[model samples]
Target: MFSRAGSSAFRCCRALPPAVFRVSQPVQYRALSSAAADAAAAAAASPRHPARPTFFRRALSFTGGALLFTSLGLIMVLGPAYESAAAILSSPSDAESLSLFTPPDEDAQAKEDFINSHPLTLSLRSDPDFIESRPHMKIPPSWRKHNLTGGTLMGPGKVAVPPFSWSEKSGKNFVQITHVGTDLCGHMGIIHGGFLATMLDEGLARCCFPVLPFNIGMTAKLEINYKAPAMANQYLVLRATTIKVEGRKAWVEGHIETLPTEEGQEPVVLATASALYISPKQASVSIRR
Candidate 1:
């Protein structure tokens, strides 16, 4: 029985399946770690982008951009304006005469008769202190070509006769009577304000030129106030009074008005102005020793 039992135990042990024993295998952890280290080194050696700009650098860039755009916009806006201004200021051309619409000879004659017979003209002629010479008429021929008022603006229908003027011998006051043609209108039937301003400048300058150092002066400043629209193709009067005079500078005020149709009638005020004139300094001579 013991033998049988021992044999039975042996058979049972043989019949049981073989037990599985787990064997430890070495892992490639070191290799994986080396590959990770190499990747880190490669990443560290690669170049990187720079940091953000400072506040001052950013502000400067913004300012430069703004100025560039602003200059371009100003050029677009001011370029045409400058051209128009230059055209107006330049001397009138021969083609500009068409704008005058010259009147018929008979009508021009009649107009001349009326102005010559005007009471204002007669009175100015009678004044001894006042000389009735045409302003700028006697300028050198070279300058006449470039003169706007005296050269180009003079004609039969236009400034009918040399402007009639009366002046005080003391250089304290001045008067000018002239006819402006219809062609010089800024708006229909209304004379241009710029034309009136030109007249005022000339009249006021004449009023103070005598008091200046060399009897000549340049306009320094002019301020004008328009009170009413001056009608075109009408006789107008410009009167100026000298306010004060210094060594080389003079101040004067003036006004433009219509010539009354009848004696003792009130003339309409068109515009008024005040101006400062400054005479150029005398040239200095240098003596070379």
Candidate 2:
């Protein structure tokens, strides 16, 4: 009976102490609290990269901008169905019609001034031989009317002179001709240099024309040295001298000079020329038109 009492007492003591034990008021969660504190500290530190701009900030800022309609433009130009984005660029000119001022009387005055100033014209009044000078009888009007050029005969100008005048002294052959620059303008007021060159070429051949057998010659090569401007409407003087006549080739030297405006003033040298004229073959001389 004593042993049974002792066992009962031990069991009752264990059950009573377990019932008396209680959980303390809930302990704060360390994991959740530490995470929250770390997050707050990080927010307070300086940022490495700036945050993305908000829509409100973009709307308020009027700074340098991106092309907002960029996607729409790309869709229009590089689309499934192409649409050309090139702008039409064109303009009309009214420059000719809207000219502000009229040009001077360049043609008439130039012609008159050139003629009146020519020294050859003054000589014509004093020297009868100069006045008597005329084209050689050998050079027919048909030849002049069918004057030779690159390969064709040039027609008469708007104004024409009477005929070429020829005279000679020593070995030099002199030819006088007058031309109105208004009729042969390379530019508006200037006489064509090519026309002057053609005249010089003719002077070269005509210097030795009287000595040729067939009365026909063709220029092989001609070089000109331009010295001064040849004005329009001037009575120019061209003098050529035969340097030598070697069988079929005739070498000639010539000069073209402008008429001086005043007495004792040297004539303005316009150009110097040298040429080689060769007798044409009989076959080349036959008339073709």
Candidate 3:
């Protein structure tokens, strides 16, 4: 019975063991994981290229360079034009004839006409005679002046005499000057204020005679009252008179008149002035060449 039981147990055990069992364990995913790691490494090792510059950036650089070049070119080409425009804008209406656009011959003709109309001439050529003839007249010592020996104060076709006079009673210092012009007026036939001032200054300076010895005489005080405008190409007279003297100071008076702006038109009082002349002692130092 024991043997039989043992045999049965063995049989049972064998039978149970004999039951075929397949151990189907999950397959290890090593290959897949290795493939993934390889892909990641490959992605990390690849070099990344930088992006190209945008169109705007390249265009901006080009535009900036072009603008700089263009500005420089314009300045070089148009600088003269700009200056001419400025001059034309600021000049007086009467100055149109003197413009660059005017013909040279026309300008010369206009100038001649103006000069012929306004003639400044005196009968007496002697400065001393002129001064002495005026009774009780006081002349400044600085009046003994001379023209620049060879220098040209008179323009072309103009004549100027040296500051000299020959009269028994007249002093040795005096100057005689003359100028002629025609149509001393603008296109509208008006005498320019600048011309009047210029005439007065010339007359006064001539009356002062020698600008040497006393090279110092500033237009310290000038008061001009314009009584009338001499028509273009009219004879104008400028007479400078020295009324008083105090040390280096002097009082000078002047008048301007038109010969025939209208019939029987007495020479009008165009302008007057009072000047203070520096003394020769004070002016000598500055006058030396």
Candidate 4:
């Protein structure tokens, strides 16, 4: 009867599942119970200490994003402001208009008194016998004359004189002119660029006049290249030539040279220039007369 019962128990144990048999063993059952308890403890602990970002980390992320956005916004707003400010600052100042002043006429008695006091006559046209009686032609009379006899070509504080003369009939159409003295210089001692440009323009115009037939020429374009600084009280001579002529246009080239102040001093090249001259609309105006 005992053997039959043992056989029956073994058959029942063989038919049961592996997991059920494993739990039936004391060592395996204790191990499974301990593992389930550890899992449950871990789940309870996770709920007590929930995952979250720290205050410092959150604050730093927010500040970084805000700074990035503010920088972009500032760039968008300040770019145009900087450009507008630069434009305003770079604009030229307005120039004033000229004023006309009339001088008082002297009577015959006053004229006689003036003539007696000042014996030397300053009239360039009247004194033909005098060596310096001729008008100061900045260029040779043969090349061309602008006829600035009755009109004042310069401001009240300015004075200019022609150094030489040339003839239109002669092939020597090119010439060198100069401007010096403290009155014409700017910035205490340096020659102003504007003044230098003006002189170049005039020289080019004078150069074209002799080349052209009859029409008065006007400056269409002038380009100056400043090679060296022009100093005050130094004689600066600008050499100009008529390079090419096409229809109503004349192309001229010029260069500025500082004359040697003392003996054996080397002449310095100050500036170079090129220009275009166009015939004026009023072609009948006599520049020679």
Please report the candidate that would top lDDT against the real structure.
1
Give TM per candidate.
Answer: 0.59, 0.47, 0.39, 0.43
Instruction: Give the Cα error of residue 226 in candidate 1, in Å.
Output: 0.4
User: Scored by Cα lDDT, where does model 2 land?
Assistant: 0.59
**lDDT, candidate 2, 1-289, per-residue tens:** 4598898988887768443344222233666678899999899885779788998888666332445466677777686323211110111121222122222356534553555455665555355333223332223333334444411322234333332345453324656655543557787767778878977887778777655555457889999988877777565777778888876778899888865557787777789999988887672455231
Query: Which residue pairs show collisions in model 2?
Result: 181-233
How many clashes would you count in candidate 2? 1
Better model by lDDT, 2 or 3? 2
State the lDDT of candidate 3 residue by residue for 1-289, as single tens digits: 5698899998887786433443222223666778899999999999988898899998999999999999999999898667655553453331222222221355445543543343322334322244322110112112212232212322222222111111222222332222333433443566666667766765565455433235235555667787766554344556666666555666577666654445466656666665555555645654442
| Per-residue C-alpha lDDT of model 1 across residues 25-44, encoded as one tens digit per residue | 22456677889999999999
- Model 3 stretches with alpha carbons more than 4 Å out: 1-122, 126-187, 210-216, 260-265, 279-282, 287-289
In candidate 4, which residue pairs clash? 137-162, 138-162, 140-165, 140-166, 142-166, 142-167, 142-168, 143-166
lDDT of each: 0.78, 0.59, 0.48, 0.57
- What is the lDDT for 59 in model 2? 69
Higher-ranked by TM-score: 1 or 2: 1
- 120-234 in candidate 4: lDDT tens per residue? 2233214443222112322223222343421233322232333321222321244443435466666877877777787677666766675665735888888899987787654
Per-residue error (Å), model 3, residue 267: 2.3
Misplaced by over 4 Å in model 1 are 1-104, 282-289
